[model samples]
Target: MSHSAEHGRVRAGYNAVAEDYQKQIGGELAHKAVDRALLGVVVEAARGGLVADLGCGPGHVAGWLAKQGASVVGIDLSPGMVEIARREHPAAEFREGDLLRLPAADGEFAAAVALYSVIHLEPGELRPAFAEMRRVLRPSGTLLVSFHLGTEVRRLDEWWGHPVAIDFHFLESERVAALLAEAGFTVEARLEREGLPEEAATRRGYLLARRDAG
Candidate 1:
């Protein structure tokens, strides 16, 4: 199937459960630690350039990045999430697109953050997505990816056990590092954070990689 179709399927699925997604990942309610850690990387670097927030939902990360004085653009698969992002953050730009195949020019961003974003991609499908991420990032720019670490694919029953159909993927960080390296990014930082919400997969991995200066 085409990337668009796959994305559409995922989008439709999420759109049907957009509210649940919000409750799970609506910034402070969820993904709070991941958000702070990601923003720290950008702020500490003090770099200025386009930063793409792949799979950005409700524009939270993009809005935060923009508040930090970086140019931010957000993209998500779900139109419902995009609508919420637009509504919540009129200052930041949010559009509908696939992370596996973005609509922007190559080397356009100085940094990219996939905050718990790649969790939706199958493990084997990550290579192409990482390549596209590197393609849009300028040489030496950083790519930040955050996820709950695991060796197997698992599904949840519900958010608050509400019987919602929302679902996501979690991949091992080691495989992610390998894939990022294969995609032309030099691994800069790789570490795991513990003590995340038990409701989430406890192990969180944050990897910061850079495109070679070449």
Candidate 2:
């Protein structure tokens, strides 16, 4: 499919499933089991300031960060997701945007998160996507990205036949670290373990990196 068509398809798909996902899953799909730990890892690995939740579906993490006193903005491609996020968490700043090309300016944010969202990208799309993420991050900023451990892109998928777009591309933590480095980030921490209820698969992993301060 053309990228534009795919974008529209993805947009419509998430827009349709946005409310249902929140209602059915809530915090189940978030990395609640390891989110706190990952957060700690992020704080330790790099300086923190303006944080952004890229591909932030429903804005849960963004809300939590704002409560913790961090300036957080949640951005997602799905309008429905952004709407739901804003409704549920008024404290957070939510915007609809594409992860392939974040709307934020270069070095605009101090810390960033991809969470369970990157798994939706095809294998080749992951690297450039990370580069775009790196571009929006300030020097020495932290980035935490996660994925389900596997090797397949589940396209034309559905959530209750509502036409949800889910693509899971399993990859190694080491490989992700290499990509981060190529994208101008320094690898700092890595973890792979049991999946959270919000995770699409049973096994998941995350990589923490920092944009090179120098």
Tens digit per residue, CA lDDT, model 2, 1-214? 7666767777788888888877775565244746776765554444546889998888877777776667788999899999999999898788889888898998889888888777767667778899899889988888998876666555667776686665456677777788888878887777788854454446778888888876
Off by over 4 Å in 1: 1-6, 29-34, 44-46, 156-167, 198-201
Tell me which residue pairs clash in candidate 2: 28-198, 29-198, 150-170
Clash tally, candidates in order: 0, 3
Query: What is the C-alpha lDDT profile of model 1 across 1-214, one tens digit per residue?
Result: 5545655566766676676666656666244665576676865553777888899887777888887787888999888889888887777888898887787898888888888888878656789999999889888888889887876666544544444333467677778889988989888878787755544547778888888777
Query: In angstroms, how far off is 62's CA in candidate 2?
Result: 1.1
RMSD of each: 2.8, 2.3
Reference-based lDDT, residue 212, model 1: 79
lDDT of 1: 0.77
Please state the error at residue 183 of candidate 1 in Å.
Answer: 0.6
lDDT of 2 at 94: 89
User: Each model's TM-score, in the order given?
Assistant: 0.86, 0.89
